[model samples]
Target chain A: MRKLFSSRTVVTIIIAFIVIVGLITGSNWLSKRTNTPPFVQRFSNDLAGGVSRLISVPTTAIGRTANSIGNLLDTFEENQILKAKIDQFAQDKVRLQTVEEENRSLKKQLGLQATLTDFKTVSAVTISRSPTTWQSQLVINQGIKAGLKKGMPVLSGAGIIGRISEVNTTNSKVALISDTSEDANRFAITIKGNSGEINGIITGFNREKNQLIMGQVTSDNTIKAGDLVETSGLGGVIPSGLFVGKVARVTKDDYGLSKRIYIEPAADLGNITTVVVAVSEIGAK
Target chain B: MAFWQLTRIRVVYPVILFFLLFVDGAVMSGMGAFFTAFPWHVLPLATLIWLFYGVQFDVDKDMPFWIYVTATGILFDAYYTGIFGTYTVAFLIATMVMKQAKNILDERLLSGLTMFLFGILTFLVITYFAGYIIGIANVSIVTFLLFEVLPTVALNAFFAVIGYFPVWSFFNFLR
Candidate 1:
């Protein structure tokens, strides 16, 4: 027994026991205690991001080259298909001009203020993607320098894109409205001829499918297929009357009072490159 | 063969651990350049330190063991941690406890695994806690376990097979 009482043996035993106990009970406490300093955390994050950018540049360039080569290998009819799309754009532009002129003439007749000038649009490009899929977030090139703030709305050319989640000095993480965990309420949405409200929560289901599901809507809203949904301006963070999506399928719950409408959001979220950040009109309550 | 003299062999393992951590950082970063998604997870280094001493029952040489333990903590802190130096304190506490476990388990594979597993687990918990303390990680509990723990365990196991022998050999030379 005396021989077993060696100083080294005793110390090792004491240390090991404490560590096991600490790990079982004090893991959270230890984690909270050892956070990196703020400045260091920010600097390291930027450095890591910058390094990743430098590393990815060559890879992206190669991918683009491959894609262009693949496109050239296709037959001539593919080119005709593209040409038709271009012609459609030309006709759409002419029609838009005619509508604008007609709208102005009608506004004069009704003496109403023009609404198109109300929105201030600033375009931005995505810089980084979150490593994990649990958080579907993107860091855009614009930041405080571009007049971006927390909760500012980001939009795809089609409809409501997301809201600014975190703003750094030169970049900001946009929490896409499609992100499932988000509890965003008060979406400024308008349905077809009703011109009233279609309210619910926005979330993303499958990244591969690139769809946004707006659920928990009221069964009384009279939502139907192909109805255009737009932002209602109730959140005050986003402007009123911005197109959000179209009602795809509407189903009632067990209670039959609340409806779960699966919205096919207007934005093709997967392919979005350039997005507009609503820098102005933040907090315009 | 003297009990007290066994300290010479014991000191070698800790020194090897300290040096490996430095190389681990540079190597992992360098590997990341090539693979882009190379499983480069930094599990707690102290586990191996604990297991090393835990297996080597003659590690009762207090002075040498503590020094090696402290060195392990410092190396881990310096290499992978965001704020730096915090891992050193956590590691020392972990190693000290491992020294006790060494008394019961003779230097063997099973004992080593036990210590290593504990070290790795502690690292995950501590680093995440550190993240919250510093505001680097604000993820929910479920996300943390999914993103941090599961991936780390897989990476650690992969590295363990490839890394263990070389590390053991280097430490054996010192012993």
Candidate 2:
């Protein structure tokens, strides 16, 4: 006993034991002693309740303040994010407005069709971009629910934009003709005198230049620069007589059987934010 | 010189805890922007910190321990900021576990070391689970681990360091 009391380890162990025992015994005593003299018990209960209230009040106040401050900071951060998004949308709105005005002027000048013939148009917003080497696709914020069925022709004011490949509840994926390996090509023949069929693949090669390439045209066909390339209506993918692009340059092959024609795409694929998806009129043929 | 005598000794530790809670709220809210996954929460961090502090300190001496534990839980579960009650349950269980562990590692130094280890481990598990549960696809594991655990550990340690002197003095005065 003397040795145990003399050591620091023993002293610490004893202190711990006493504390544990005291806590257990005290709790047990309180539980058992609840049935006591009425006045004395009432007074003790009131004191305990008052102490509990005192402890609770400050803790609750601090907690409320902490929560409010946290909420305030969150509100400030969220407001900043919302403000940034609004600014981006505002700039986009201005560009879109300019485009809309220019499109109205072009429509009045061209007088192509009163309502672009028969194709149904659905408005879609660009939402996301896929990361890939050659297969660049975009997710648009319109889906099957928005009357955007699969294989629908997408377009900007200039001409045919792309096609809807995938559809979801609130979004759809579009595969642009410019994406490498996409063979969304169709035959085009001019409507003027000496009309001849020309087979060319349409692709968006340079985004910044807004250029689409139409190659593999037969050398026998007399084609000129600025000749309008319209859908031959033969490919079954795109509608007949829809404007694709204009012939920019033509180069004869080694054998001279076919000519590779460079065509500038009518649609500006780079800056496309909103597009009109043309829903196919089933059984309209 | 006479500050100790003028102030109520009983209220000191709780007051310090209250102040630290405020700092914790601010720093964690700022960090939440980065730490947030799909569901949007910072409870895991708060729970981990509360547990570490409970385990390392003399929690047995905490008067009306349930009150503080409940308060910590309420503060941790600010889900109106996002989804509700995700943090409250986490903090309550965490503090309870730490209180149990405190019985075993009673010494300050040993408890502190254990607290640091637990702090790191809990942070990792919570972040991993947060990502998994919330379906945050495309973020790398290394990026998640570094961002989630490292900042929290550093921040908690910073607070602990600043708090050490005051805590020590208060305990010493009480003794």
Candidate 3:
């Protein structure tokens, strides 16, 4: 028994324990207290991103081929869908033209300037997604060197995907809207009713249904299914008017005092390859 | 002279382990992108594999092997973002358990396979629990076990099997 508790093993174990404790505390402090990622962390991520880009070429090719085959299989159905979309798009184009003219006239009459959402956009390609299951973060190739900043809104072709979580010199990480972590609850958004006055907060993501759960909605608000939801710009970082999603359904909360609206996200969060970072102008509110 | 030779031979392990870490972070992640449809989360558990290999081959239970395990764990934690020290502590505990159990377990292919499976399961459970305690993991136990744990175990086990022979041959060649 005495031999089992040898001084060497005891010392090693103690040292290991101290090291473990130090690491946990240090990392937590770094993540929470620091505004920017440490230089070592950024360098490592950039190096890994570069290597991942090189390794992704073959896999990207395979993915492209698989997508091509799937597209080919669905060509006839897609063609029909496209035909229907074309007619709808033609009508939308006319409506959009009239709205644009009215918007221009209103801006001229009011002498209003461009809003925060009218920032410059820089394109970026996803280098890798974090392997950890808890967080759904994507590392994009462009970073602070390209004028990307933390809290800047990221948009896909469809609509808003997420916001920049961390920015390094050459790459950045985007924390997806599906991330249900407590730190990820900064998105202040609103549901656009016919009256345009319904406001709610995106509380969490329903993974089973693949929907965003928006809660804190007043029972008095006449929100219904199919209402357009968007960022309220209430959170100073994210600009207003960025499309979030359509309300799939509305239900009473457990307390039955407020409503919880399930949103079908506009951007496909699961399968993103490229994104645009909306770089807000300096000092833009 | 004999001690010097042994130290020189053991140097290769750390080199190989570092290389594996790089490949796991860079290459394996990109490969995971291809399997978007399936719930296939392919993370390379090279450190776990190294622990298994150490359990199987290091009959003498050398100090260098333990150091390798510790260093690999620390490096993995440094590279991966999340609750730091989770992997390091998990790997250390796993190594200690394996070292204690090595006497009863025979040095054979079946034992190696069993150890590999058990090691991976233990490592993942520890990681999950540690992350949960640190407030990083928001996943429920059932969801984590089903979607993340099961797929990660299966994929990592496949990597361990494919990696076994080459690693075995390399260690032997180093000797």
DockQ for every model comes to 0.06, 0.08, 0.31
TM-score of each: 0.50, 0.35, 0.82
Q: Ten consecutive residues with minimal summed lDDT in candidate 2 chain A?
A: A127-136
Clashing residue pairs, backbone N/CA/C < 3 A, model 2: A178-A204, A212-A265
Candidate 2 versus truth, CA RMSD in Å, comes to 21.9
Q: Every prediction's TM-score for the first chain?
A: 0.66, 0.50, 0.85
**lDDT of each model, Cα atoms only?**
0.54, 0.50, 0.70
- Residue B37 displacement in candidate 1 (angstroms): 17
| Top-DockQ candidate index | 3
Best by TM-score: 3
Top lDDT hit? 3
Instruction: State residue A36's C-alpha deviation in candidate 1, in Å.
Output: 18
Give one digit per residue, the lDDT tens place, for model 3 in B1-175.
5666754446656666665655554443344444333343445566567667767778233347767777767656544553378777778777677666666778677677777777777777877766655565655788767776777778777877787788788767767
**lDDT for model 1:** 0.54
Give residue A234's error in model 1 in angstroms.
3.4
Give the CAPRI class of candidate 1: incorrect
Encode model 3's per-residue lDDT on A57-162: one tens digit a residue: 6645565566677669999998998998898899999998999899878978999776544567899987666555455577788988897777788998688877
How much DockQ does model 1 earn? 0.06
Q: What are the per-residue Cα lDDT tens digits for candidate 2 across A1-285?
A: 356365788888788656544543343234224322234333432333233233434433554465567668789778988987998899999998998788778878998443323356678655333221123345566764686655667786687767765454455656666543232232333322145656555533543233565555554767677777765544454555666678777677568776766676677554454678865443124
Once superposed on the true structure, which residue ranges of model 1 sit more than 4 Å away at CA?
A: A1-53, A62-88, A101-117, A156-159, A183-186, A193-211, A219-222, A240-243, A268-274, A280-285, B1-175
Question: What proportion of the true contacts does each candidate reproduce?
Answer: 0.00, 0.00, 0.24
